[model samples]
Target: MEQLATFGAGCFWGVEALFAEQQGVTSTTVGYMGGHTPRVTYNDICQGDTGHAEVVQICFNDSVITYSQLLQLFWQNHNPTTPNQQGPDFGTQYRSVVFYHDQSQQQQAVEMRQTLNNMGLFKAPVITIIEAANQYHLAEDYHQQYLLKRGKASCSL
Candidate 1:
């Protein structure tokens, strides 16, 4: 099945860039997830009270990239040990999280987390949560394809 994976690993820009570069990632989007609100503005989420996380929704071809492979890439790209932060970005919105789409993913996330923890890969324990996806609010137009279009103005992180 063609599957989707949603993750919040700090700033969506860096997270989006990493997944977009992956071979099997057919499509990717910057968005907010794991929030109670149906649709929330980016500004609101930034304030840290929206209960939403800054996330990237990845659409990948399962034929080419297994979810486990994607998860591996995810672990390599971001710091899951830090709670509510990635690099300079901090707060609950930037919290490390994984929004599993189904039961298999839930199990995979748990297993992967255990493996990573057992390996002693990081100082802080992996705080990424695997929650059932609720709603995904696509980022504004200016935020879409941000790394591609704004390469000159901003660093790729």
Candidate 2:
């Protein structure tokens, strides 16, 4: 069966583009999560008051790509130590996070992060959040796959 994983690295554009090309990912959706409001706009997320992070939800076939594989990709794609920033994007809304749907995912995220830390893979400590799935508000159509069709989309992770 297909399962879901949610992550917030930075601008959803590049993140979505990167993951959409990964093997075993059934689909990807850009959205906002870890916010108080049920429906938050992109502008509001940019403002940071919404407490929402621009996130991507990946639907992948577990048989093809394990959750651990996705975690590795997440670690490789963005800077997790900077705290609320990736590449040029700087704000709380761009914080690095991994939203897990269950205990297995939670354990995997935690273990993978710990392994990275032990391996000194990151120059600084990782700040990626491993939390329960929060309300995920889908982004507008234009923001869905901004980088695939548009070449000059946000390059921030």
Candidate 3:
């Protein structure tokens, strides 16, 4: 079966690129999520006042890649310990978050985060938020597969 997973970890450009290269990730859409705006744009998110985070919504085949494995990638790819920030990006839009689509996903997200915390994986506490999936407004066309289109492997900060 296919499943949906949404995450906000730094720039969506790199995040989308990373997942796009993953084995089971069938598709990815860079977007804005966990916000109140009805029709948010990349500009609005950049302002950092929309309560939205730059996120990538991924569709994956569970048979090939477990949600737990995806969670591990999420934890490993970004610094979840920093609140409302990641690398050179600093704002709520860059916050680390996991948007669970179902009760099972919710449980998994919570447990994974807790496990990382218990392990003291970082010098500081992990502040990544585990929240219910919210409205995901797809970003402009130019934003999708940005790295790939530009022939760049990743976002440079």
- The CA lDDT of each predicted structure is 0.87, 0.89, 0.93
Name the Cα RMSD for model 2: 1.7
How many pairs collide in each candidate, listed in order? Answer: 0, 0, 0
Better of 1 and 2 by TM-score: 2
Per-residue CA lDDT of model 2 for 20-132, tens digit only, reads 88889999999999988878989888777988999999999999999999999999989988888888789989999999999999999999998888889888988788889
- For model 3 the local lDDT of residue 27 reads 99
TM-score of 2: 0.94
lDDT of 1 by residue, 26-140 (tens): 9999999888887799999988888999888999999999999988888888899888888888899988898999999999999999999998998878878889998899999
lDDT (Cα) of model 2: 0.89
Give the TM-scores of the predictions, in the order they appear.
0.94, 0.94, 0.98
Predicted structure with the largest TM-score when compared to the true one: 3
lDDT by residue for model 3 (1-157), tens: 9999999998999999999999999999999999988899999988988999999999999999999999999999999999988898899999999999999999999998899899997898889999999888999999999999999999875
Question: Could you report the Cα RMSD, in angstroms, for every candidate shown?
Answer: 1.7, 1.7, 0.7
> Cα deviation of 102 in candidate 2 (Å)?
0.8
Better by lDDT, candidate 3 or 2 = 3
